[model samples]
Target: MRQLLSYGLFGVIFFHLFFPHNISAQSVDTVYFSLDMTEPISEGWLKHGTEIVGIRGDQSPLNWGNTFEASDPDKDGIYEVAVPFNLHSDSLLVSFKIKVDGVNNPDDGWQKGRNHEAMIYQGVKNKVTLKWADEPPQAPTTITGQVEIFRDFQSDNLVPRDLYVYLPPGYKESNQRYPVLYMHDGQALFDASEIGQEWRVDEAAEELIRAGEIEPVIIVGIGNTQNRFDEYTPTEQVWRYELNRISSQERTTFPEAFAGNYISTEGDTIRFKTKHDTLLTMIPGGQFWQPLIPESEHAFFLAQAGITFTFDVKETEVNQVVASKPTMGGDGDLYGGFIIKKVKPFIDQNFRTRPEREFTSLGGSSLGGLITLYLGLEYQDTFSNLLVVSPSVWWDGQMIISKVNELPGATNQHIWLDMGTAEGEGAVESAKALNKALLNKGWSKENLNFVIEEGAAHNERAWAKRVPDMLRFLYSKN
Candidate 1:
């Protein structure tokens, strides 16, 4: 079984009632969208005759998969479109983004950040005006504390990237050493995120420290690169195959009966053999026997031969079948080594840090969260506190759970594991399973905190909302 579970019953009901597929015309409200393309037009990025502007969103008449065209009938730089919504209640929220030169052209434009949100209500203008799509939102003046950047910090184990350090208040005058909290995705941690949305960690930390709700800590934001997926995942995914039910005679074609196994690499091709000596072979990206061959390196469509193959890979070897396509990962150990061997030493040397395991914490969300847990397990002496938020436990067939099972016993660490009720049932279930695994491995409830946030989505905004709570849980003065 996949071993994943959680869904918000209220969110489900709300979705069904307000955003159903078959919304009646009487309940529909039209929302007007206007995009100012002055910059793109002036920069020659969008040639009037060669390209056009459109909208993509998560609502009717607009979806992320397709583009809806907007027009500039008055020959002005502002393009406009009106989309209808089924607004039975007093208000509805719609998320959308602007795309220039259609969906096929990636170079010209794709709005950054979390999708732009707008609220729709009865007897309202419901107009949304976007100045630009390809730029970061203006930094809010309300940003608290100070941020220092180490431009393109070099690392032997990973690519060079900038490191943003958030210094707590009163660091210069007071010679006090503080605990350090290392977080991944440096770009999204503050107001200057490449994507318009940010976690506002600096603001949250400043607030908590001022209120004396949590201990003041230095936050190190490690920037991510193109190798993010590989760096964040602890193991490489390898393909698994399972036997499909077929005629007895066809089953005899293979030597001995077997459930499934990982596809092994032969001289030049990948092969899977049965215990009784039946063999299946094919070069990746090449054709094999008409109906029994793999179509590509990532897919095998052999339904006719009483055998089924999945492109999805598991971190650990498994005998069951899966349906997801294969993706690159497995560089997490190297990434962790980069931080441990290179990043941390530099931070400790330059910053006024406590430089102790108990004072050092590691955290991130989604895949970053996955790597945090992996590193926490592997390097207990380095990081004694972990903030794992909405971790992708489903990665590599929930291999992290298996890793938890393999541990001799839990160490003395303060661990926080959380998942939103709206982040999908599988994610919630995986978190629940991980929580159970930790308990089974002897982690006391007092040391581990598991939270399921209601109506929270998997994004920077949602993660931002939990920052105060996470900090308090990890560094509460009381």
Candidate 2:
């Protein structure tokens, strides 16, 4: 339901957005996205020529009877609206969607989004994004490339999905075929220079490739779907188990109940035990969070509320837990043709990469890491190398654990796996299981490598710090 609500919100948002300056259905000025401001703008936007195309306020709701009149839309911050009139002249007026994107850049909870003009979304980023207009903007000479990060505008497929493709230093002058690094979660992988962290894959790749430390690999970072669990899990759910229940009067409301592969890690894991049910409340001004209840009683309270939940990997079972579709990513596992074939093709072709499997690689973190493992092992013909970083190996399905023993030997492939020691007990076990599994398969140290960082936690900063080395390990011939 939470996921459904989010999707519903996005539908309303996208519609008003595409039609931002209302045009009647039968009107000749009929156009979808006629006066669109798809990219978030800064406070002082300066452009040539001028005309009042139309003004449309965001459509979220008048906040709490405050007749607020407008909502600073989350996506791109365009203030989606509808207008009966058109721009007064053949010339188009430059409008402004000034924003102050801070730690979090707002979007419709879709795409790789950010604040209006936060430090991260300024400057060099101007060259990275291609504002979605009727025609590409006549960007300044300094602006090197224009790109778009897209996702399905449908309820059934609303994921935090996107990709980043870089243009060579002199892309406009040459038609070159560069090697590609098809990364997972392209949105969050790059440095904060693009409203992201500072592992600047582009800067790193461009420099190293130029120096011959690694091949010149154009990176395409695929964002994780909001529902990563769905993408990572192979079976409908993660695991399957039955539940039988009876009440005091020997009366039962239902005969069975379960959730697929969605295990209760809090029960078996010490790390989770220390972390209670916490919620981060992000209001307009600032964000803060705390344990929902006193942590001292968290355990006892949970035991009393035993919600009779079990894990399943079957569709018939998942439908019962979630009558509709998954609301967020990483609930279980995900592996499908669209990502394996469609997305991969899109990145490869656009970057003019070598059209062979030998130079190709797949990499990801956490659930994405698990999926990378699954993809490489299952489709070795397509992806020859795997870079799985700090994978949530304990995900109920034990997805990785179950599949490592069956992977192709190291002789024909290379695998770079790492975990942070700070992630707690399961981290060590997961790494050990993987190490043992590969070793038992006659894999050598040359083909498989795993690292355990002493203090790295499960966050973007930690990943960003190691991204450079990971890239080197995966693509560097040196």
Name the best candidate (by TM-score): 1
RMSD of each: 11.8, 17.8
| Per-structure clash totals for the candidates | 4, 43
Question: Candidate 1's residue-wise lDDT over 1-478, tens digit each?
Answer: 1332121221222222122233456667788888898877786656553344677765554654345567787767889988876665787666678876422344436766556777789878788888775443454443458988888999876889989899998888799999999999987897633545678899999989988888888999999987888999999975433332221222322222222332322212233443323234332232342222344443444322212355343333233333233445899999999999989999999999999998999999999998999999899999999999989887777899999999999988899999986554355778999999999999887999999997666677779999989989888899
TM-scores of all predicted structures: 0.65, 0.51
Candidate 2 clashes: the total is 43
lDDT of 2 by residue, 87-203 (tens): 223322121222221112344112233311211111121111223232323322221233345554122334535566665455556677766667766656554544324345665
- Cα distance off (Å), candidate 2, residue 370: 0.4
Candidate 1, residue 423: lDDT? 58
